[model samples]
Target: MTYRIGYIVGSLSSVSINRRLAGALVALAPDTLEFFEIGIADLPLYNRDLDGDYPEVARRFKGDVESADGLLIVSPEYNRSMPGALKNAIDWGSRPWGTNSFARKPTALLGTSSGSIGTAVMQAAMRNVLSFLNVPQLSSPEAYITFKPDEWDGDMVTNESTRAFLTHYMAEFAAFVERVLAHAPGHIGDEG
Candidate 1:
């Protein structure tokens, strides 16, 4: 019952706290989910002029979006909005007009930040984008973490409450993915 999930992160810094938070989730994700991080750092800034003949990277990224059953977005607040790289990835996946790869794909938003805001505003912006693509998103059990540097010892999320919270959150997201797959055309796990 494993679901393939396309993953994206909002930060590009070499020592991004957002990346570490995503790593923690990866280490904690359940067996029912298989994550594949799609690197957006290599993508050129999205431009409509290139839509007619998308770059190799753009085509590959679209293919990645199409093949996955769902998406898991990990973000950090950047000046009260989503990072440009992540926004560019979304734009690339949404285009060439009426061929959005994300339409109807189940998605969830999880984010962390040192500030109290915790990417709430950024996720809101993403919500509007995904809504336009007709993608389904998880709205319950929100993750808006204010990260602490001392909260881990490599990969593991050491805080007991945070670990417990994420364990349940993953289970909830797994259920959401199942519901989405059941509703999708040519649902993957269906048996005729």
Candidate 2:
């Protein structure tokens, strides 16, 4: 069965490397996976007051999260943590009490940065938040890509080793998603 995967790119920059990395991952993904971006650029800073009467954009964001069979969060490190825009989107998805849109959604987190360590710290912080929301995540084959202009050709990874690793990561994530969904209550492919 095909899986509808919603991806969030944490950077708001028009020329974001993380965005390019996300594109490469999508291109390398299996045919059974369909990737779509979940835009976080327009979401306002989340506030509890607004949760009572969620804005149209917030509603749309939540709807996107709810409809997806799986999620991929591609983030960039900002001051040793996740970008503000990404945090804002996460807050919107987990708000209004007992209405977490990310609950039980199979997720995989990866990020790219110019530094050698990449987005390790930011991913750690994100893991805490997503864990609290009960989002199931793929924890293995952690990707901490160091952005290098020479290693990429537009939206494709030109480095042979990096491309092979990313391709393998995508395959692993596809299997993880399918396994999680098959066991989810009332899922279409559920055999139990």
Candidate 3:
């Protein structure tokens, strides 16, 4: 059975390394998993006024999150926290209060930074937010990445050791997703 996985890019820039990592992970997806890129950049900020008259963009964003069996967020840390754009996207989806798109969905976080901390701290911040959203995240073999700006290209995960780690991370993430879907209420196979 195929699972629809939404890969969210936290940064909007065309050259964003975080986005590139998400794309690379998608490329590694097996035939049973279909990866969809969730366009977070194009969304407008959350507004109660707009909620009643939902824009096409908002509807699509909500649909993507709602339809996916799980989510993969390639977060980029900004000032040691999750980027505003990424946080905003989640805020939008977690609304019309109590009917969050992410409710009960499985999510995995992977992040990269030019600094030594990678995205460890941001993940901590996100853990709080995820708790509020009631989203179930993969809990083992936590995925994290750090890279030196001088050593890598925009799209290629060229650091050999980092690449190997990320490859292993993706495989584990896929299995975690399968396990999550297997047990979620009413989530059975492709129907998820």
Candidate 4:
């Protein structure tokens, strides 16, 4: 009755607001859902030539995505788009010419920023790429928020409204994950 989700945080910074948001999601998630950060910092910039003999790091990242039941991506807008590290990871996941690891996986996106835009354009760019990768992303109840430092008490969001909304979204994500697993071919509801 547990679902393991492989997650990606677009920023490499230790103090990334988007990374904090992802951690908050984990704290709010139902017991049935567990998250593991899929590290992308070690991956080289994806090159097609490297696809034939992928580095062990890239292969491990791909395996993490393939083994997991779903994906959770939290990205902050960088230059009006997702960060380079995350994009490189995505390219690595969908590689070797028709051997994409992310194909048909259930996914969700969330992010926060200091600005009013709240990662909207970054998410849009990500959506286009994920569409090509065949990742079925949740379309409703999106979390795009302006970061408020005063609202965070340690890793948890102290603001009542933000906490409430995130809690509800995590519950919904639990159900979405369940449905994705139930319908996945050969899934026996115990996939890691």
- Model 1 residue 138 CA deviation (Å) reads 0.6
* lDDT (10s digit) by residue, model 3, range 1-192: 777888898888877878777866776656667888888888888787776777888888988888888899998888888999999898888766656788878889878877777799899899889887778887776767765666566666667776776677777777888887787743322321
Residue 167 alpha-carbon offset, candidate 3, angstroms: 1.6
RMSD of 3: 3.4
Clashing pairs in 2: none
What candidate 4 gets wrong by more than 4 Å, as runs, is: 186-192
Model 4 lDDT, full chain set: 0.86
What is the lDDT ranking, best to worst? 2, 4, 1, 3
Better of 3 and 4 by TM-score: 4
User: Tens-digit lDDT track for model 2 on 1-192?
Assistant: 999999999999999999999999999999999988899999988988886799999999988988899999999999989999999998998876778888888999999999999899999999998998888899999999999999999999999999999999999999999999888832222111
What is the alpha-carbon lDDT of model 1 when measured against the actual structure?
0.83
- Per-residue lDDT of 166 in model 4: 94
Q: Report residue 110 deviation for candidate 2 (angstroms).
A: 0.5
Q: Write the per-residue lDDT of candidate 4 for residues 1-192, one digit (tens) a residue.
A: 998998898999988888889989999999998889999999999898887799999999988988888899999999999899999999888887667888878899979999998999999999999997877888878888899999997778999999999999988888887887688742222211
lDDT of candidate 1 over 38-144, digit per residue (tens): 88889999999998999999999988888888888898867878888898998998888867888878888889888887788888888887787788899998988
Name the TM-score of candidate 3.
Answer: 0.89
Clashing pairs in model 3?
none
Task: Tell me the RMSD of model 2 versus the true structure.
Answer: 3.5
